[model samples]
Target: MAKQRIGIYPGTFDPITNGHLDIIKRGLRLVDKLVIGVATNPSKDPMFSLSERVAVVERETHDMAKVAGVEIDVMPFDELLMKFAERVGADIIIRGLRAVADFEYEFQMTGMNYQINPNIETVFLMADPRYQTIASRLVKEVARYDGNIEAFVPSMVASEVVKRVNESKV
Candidate 1:
């Protein structure tokens, strides 16, 4: 039997978009086990709480996790990404590249992550063309203004985004 290869896909995923799901689905092809690392990004304020973020991912991806043979686990992690990868026994870190700008930023981060943990590798998956322009920041901006977001996120996630945004206004 072949050894199980673990892949870690780390992100804030404030309100995971279909674009993010596209990467997760494609990323599963490279490893036996896919671990979605929901990290706490200190730089940006998230519309959803950590628990809410995790629930949204779980709810949105429940069907995929159930039907896919590749084992899937979504868990929250707070330490350094490389450290989290190491702790989880990840052989590779999966990243999504939507454009050249993403590559430029990920390139630097990849170099640093490699330096921190040379044993692990980073794999970049190009965004599905349909999802290339969809981004969480832009989605949030739209949601805040009561714009339609059904196209970008799962129906459940869209509800959560709207619910959270409306609650904040009250």
Candidate 2:
């Protein structure tokens, strides 16, 4: 039997913007199974905790898994990304590119990841034009100032972001 093509989509997913979801949905099309690795990067000062981030990804991607007929798993990892991919048995690492600036950063990371594990390939998916400008950081910035974020994130995530922002102000 052929081996399953497993791919890892690792991110901080602070509040999982629409662009992230878009990447997950599209990434599923390229692999038989996908592992969404939520990173606990304290350096980024994420809006959500690792557990909260995992729950948010699970809740948001539940339907996509069923519709795509692809097995999806959400996991939290704080170790090196290549190590996480190796642990997940990932044959590919799925990345989303929004613009040239993103590519410049991703290109360097991809090269390093490749050097770490040549067997694992990195695939880049361009963000749909509509969501190209939507980023988790900018989404939080907008929500922090009471700007509308429904267009950038799911309703649940939008509410969560607002709640967190409001709580932080207290």
Candidate 3:
């Protein structure tokens, strides 16, 4: 039997976007199971709750996971990513590099992750050109201004972003 290839792609995923789904699909090709970790960062208050983020991620990836024959689980975690990766028995850490700045940060983190667990390898996937400019922060900013985010996020998430924006206005 072959060894299981488990990959951990940890992010805030405030509201999982189509760009994220793209990375998940691509990551699935490299691993049998991909766990999308929604960061439960205590310091930063997100527009969407942790559960909401996880729910959207799960919903968006449900069909893709089934069709691609890759197991996908969306879970919330508050811990060092390396520790979370180790706890989940992940053999690979996946990061999506959209630009040079992202690479600089991820590159530093990848080195630290490797030091913590030499057995675990980090894989960087360049974002699809279409999504190269989509960032969650910018998405939220646009949604706050009632700008159309249909091109950046899934319909469900776009709705959630709108809902949250409206709630915040109240």
Query: Candidate 1's error at 18, in angstroms?
Result: 0.3
Model 3, residue 23: distance off in Å is: 0.4
Model 1 pairs in collision? none
Per-residue lDDT of 1-170 in model 3, one digit per residue for the tens?
99999999999987777788899999999999999999998566688888888888888889999999999988899999989998999999898999999999988998888888899999999999999999988999999999999999998788889988999999
Q: Higher lDDT: candidate 1 or 3?
A: 1
Give the TM-score (vs. native) of candidate 1. 0.96
**Candidate 1 Cα misplacement greater than 4 A, ranges:** none
Question: Against the hidden true structure, what lDDT does model 2 obtain?
Answer: 0.96
Which lDDT tens digits does candidate 2 get at residues 98-128? Answer: 9999999999999999899999999999999
By TM-score rank, best first, the candidates go 2, 3, 1
RMSD to the true structure for each prediction, in A, is 1.0, 0.6, 0.9
Candidate 3 stretches with Cα past 4 Å from truth are none
